[model samples]
Target: MTRLDTLSARGRDFLGSTHAIMAGAMTWVSERNLVSAISNAGGFGVIACGAMPPHILDAEIAATKALTDRPFGVNLITLHPAMADLIAICGKHDVSHVVLAGGLPSGAAIEAIKATGAKLMCFAPTAALAKKLVRSGVDAIVIEGSEAGGHIGPVSTSVLAQEILPVIRDVPVFVAGGIGRGAAIAAYLEMGASGVQLGTRFAAATESVAHANFKRAFVRASARDALASVQLDPRLPVIPVRALKNAGSEAFAAKQREIANLVDAGTIGLAEGQLQIEHYWAGALRRAVVDGDIESGSLMAGQSVGMVTSVMQVAEIIDELVGEAEAALSNRAA
Candidate 1:
């Protein structure tokens, strides 16, 4: 039997009822409505709590519960100042899964959540960190490659998963980055991943909260659009973020230079626009996602954006992905 057919016994056990294909925890976009849709559709949905306040996150969690009885997750960015409060809220709501994005969570935070019996999911960039998180008590680890959207590690999923999966025997490993279809999912499963997580494909889903123009951008995006910018000097002070190459990104690159010049001159305060790339929000992204302004907004998409051609409902998206994995496995046998 092929690896896809005989997935890791431990990996399968971790996924339980909801199959692979986890929806990423996108800030501002992963509200209750979107999170509920993915979970109700049989894939795991994560409420992006990275940006919301604790009270707001609690309400969002309640809202998600109102929408579906199936298990879902909450995404907590490890670097945020409010991490403790968010963990408290997750436990209060009995949120079963907490995905620690951006970086690993603090040891105290991890212990607190574990005490609540919540499954912890974290991103590990290297084999060392992967084993470290396993020892740190993470229930599962998402190996995010340089191909993933938003902030990413230097390593690719192919390299990280291959090196880490072999050493970590207890926790399930989910591969993220450049995954948009069933063929990729099947390949990862064959590689011993418990499941695959998708971000860009869902950003274009019918129920996605991203701007319509943003969605179109993702649908039209290519691998070339997903290049990671070089941070020549760490002292320059800019957070490295993975975004599609567009006027916004290019403009932001220039803006960074200007901001640096101003900071050196002591002319303007650096309190706001810390990540000027995000300010491109005022550009086309708002018009595209919220106003359906498909031409103007900066669409945040993965390299897999090119793989998507049409807008599909949540259920259709899940069905098509699963079908693709099945077909690839079947053909491998033939």
Candidate 2:
């Protein structure tokens, strides 16, 4: 086996994929076509169940299954109202792996997904949460740093890796956020990351169903263009989103101000205010990814987006990443 394969054996076996790399789930972009393409390309693909109801997710899983026989996973938002029903849907589909994200999953939700016998993965933003997830019967933990697109925590990928990798050994720990190249993959693997997940690079993949304009925007953007949304009020509790700067970012700031005022005036409860923000993001992302509204749609992208210079096929992307990783390992031995 190649040195890369040897180092990634644990992750490869766990994921039942040729490489330890996983395609990060991006809402509106991670539908059936892209998910199946990633799985077919020898990396793991995850269906983004962002704000999707159970029936839609059920149909999407079935469609992805129809396209690729390779093992792929599904990502479900923990904050969704029908999270339990969504878990049941995954169980019905007999999905090999189920990723719980968007928030810390409840004990019941964890047990419910585990009952389906699917390998369970959850996002851990800190070392303490990583340990807690392992103790709560989580099969794996994905640490996505602040550099990631969409919703993000406060730490960088390197810091999260340093804090969690050596400490969490009982279950495989996957490092994500700002990881776009094989050398970065090799660096994390050397740090004891069982696997790496990338989204921005894959969102521009030729196989992705995202609009042509959306893909173009990604290719044109540099790292500095992707900025995180600021929190207008501490009481509103907005989860910061990372995306390419545009009119949509400014619109979001306005939306936050609107919500904050509503909360201040007792027009909506804190929970309702948060829900409105989530709804707004889901709609805005659809406009950009599905309708080609790049100027005003949410162009969610990670810092690695600057690395995405062009649209490439899924196979080519995976091959390049794997080759880069292999070269990195080989050079280190010299």
Clash pairs (backbone) in predicted model 1 = 210-289, 211-288, 211-289, 212-288, 213-294, 284-296, 284-297, 285-297, 285-298
Candidate 1 lDDT, tens digit per residue, 142-188?
88887787766777878887898788768788899988879888888
Cα distance off (Å), candidate 2, residue 107: 1.5
Q: How far is 10's C-alpha from truth in model 2 (Å)?
A: 0.6
Q: Please report the TM-score between candidate 1 and the true structure.
A: 0.90
TM-scores of the candidates in the order shown: 0.90, 0.98
For model 1, the local distance difference test gives 0.76
Decoy 2 TM-score against native? 0.98
Best by lDDT: 2
Q: Write the per-residue lDDT of candidate 2 for residues 45-156, one digit (tens) a residue.
A: 9999988899999999999999999999999888799998999999999999999997889999999999998999999998998899999999999999999999899999
Relative to the true structure, how large is the alpha-carbon lDDT of every model? 0.76, 0.93
> Candidate 2: global Cα-lDDT?
0.93
For residue 231, model 2's alpha carbon misses the true position, in angstroms, by 0.7
